[model samples]
Target: MTAAVAVIGTGTAAGWGRHRLGRLVAEQTPERAWFHVHPPHHDLWGAREPVVCDAQLLDCFAAGLRAELPVVVSAAPPKPDGPTQRSYAGLAALSRPSGRILVGVHPADAARVPFAAAGCGLLSRAVPGLPTGAREVHGEVAVEALPGWMVGTDASGEPVTVNLPPGATVLVCGAGAAEVVSTVAVTGRTVGSVAGADVA
Candidate 1:
């Protein structure tokens, strides 16, 4: 087994007045996989509403990822295809100073969704020895396997950096009474192995 850390994402069809942590490890939602643990560890969200993710928990997650395994794959279906015409104004433009990215990855190719609205933006720095594949969102760029070990802030995902040794089990907590448990597995083309094994 490897180590993995879950980060907060968007909300879902969850209850109102409750913050739902986006927990997905390979496009598999908590409803689908038991390993997804992006919920609260304690009664943090008990009487409160609009639960904010714990910064300390994020730190713990980042630590677990440092020495563990991290394989970034599509944990959800690629965003739906729409008009090539892109729009970026109002809060959408300001809220995301770094903009957003959408991608679809397969064993063969990964397509990158082009953000034509933002014609020019610096691409993320190179991840020296990781696998690379194109995203199928047309004019998009290749989606690099996000570093699970050492990570720098990009303002986009602004993901928490977790440092874990090989085969570490991490407990994650989120709003309400929810929790997710996840781990990372290491191997050469190890991502493929873990994904295949997971599917099985």
Candidate 2:
């Protein structure tokens, strides 16, 4: 069985948070692979060349899941159109039975979250604020009142907060968020366990 598969997206084209979360999941897994579907023109940090396919990106993603390896698919924001919507629907069907997850990073692709959540076995969201490079905090982001154990820091530099209910996880990355400096500190703390459980 595939350990885990995640489709990550962000509202903006920059994709910093989306990439960060994907990288985090990849780092935590034992033998992980990266795939970029509909990749941007600029080079991605750890992803390989684009996996183009006639099915509007579903083939490559399906291949990854079938490999039974921990994989992350970096995709464009989901659209409501026929082809795009069907592709996401296909993603959900492939992921759910295998017990994987889909992530919507901060400033998530609002259009994609619902489809992603429906298709995957589990759904996680990095909420509150988009990861920023500013040295000092510009403003406060409102953390959602989710129900589970929350990981990651708030804008005030607090250690942890409570949100994201069971069978789900939430990672908070506010403006001026640490650039995921340590996998142990960020992903390893939360996502590592999530992936590890599924793999076992």
Candidate 3:
């Protein structure tokens, strides 16, 4: 009754696109991605807080969750509107139990919550040859290699790159990994990625 997960930021042209910050004047597309779902216990380790983000480039891509655990910074969700393009485009995590990790880019609730990460992993194949490895859903956990990367808009800011493998144990669902990935090849902004306990 007290485990958390929620990271959903669909803003900008619609809502949730890496927090879409006033682009040229703002006004992307895809209806600005909605923006919602981020509740790691009332906005990250709650205590009635707002405006979290001490900044430091968040150790450049989580830096393994702030050089090995322990972080502080909340409040960075508001795609007021711009050349917006975000509904679920990258960034969405939900791993808490004190470990605290619900990154949905912005909005809250691990991007509209739909979490389930049992164990062993590796779910990437909706087409293109197939064969990544790791399996065992419902029958009792066994998923691995939840890997895949390629965020967006670098020079303008907001870019995450991480495509690891080899004995992997990951959790990087940017844009909810395009609603369950399947082979990941997003154009921009994600609006879905639900795992009912499989997908790696």
- Work out the TM-score per prediction: 0.17, 0.18, 0.17
lDDT of 2 by residue, 3-122 (tens): 332232324434776566645644543332221112111221222222222232333334333322122332322222454334333433321121112222222233343333323322
Return the lDDT, model 1, position 70.
Answer: 19
Could you arrange the candidates by lDDT from highest to lowest? 2, 3, 1
Per-residue alpha-carbon lDDT of candidate 1 for residues 1-200, written as tens digits (9 for 90 to 100): 12222222222333321222222232331111111111111222121111122333223333433322112221231122222111211112222112122212221211111121112211211112211221112221222221232123456854334333222233445662121111121111122223212110
Cα deviation at 125, candidate 2, in Å, is: 0.9
Please write out the lDDT profile of model 3 over residues 1-200, one tens digit for every residue.
22322222222334433334323112321112121112121221222211222233223323422222112212222221322223323242211111111222222322222321111011112111111121111211111122234444467675444433322233556775535443232321132333322222
Q: Count clashing residue pairs per candidate.
A: 35, 5, 58
lDDT of each: 0.22, 0.29, 0.25
Better of 1 and 2 by TM-score: 2
**What's the CA RMSD for each of the models?**
21.5, 21.8, 21.3
True-structure lDDT of candidate 2: 0.29
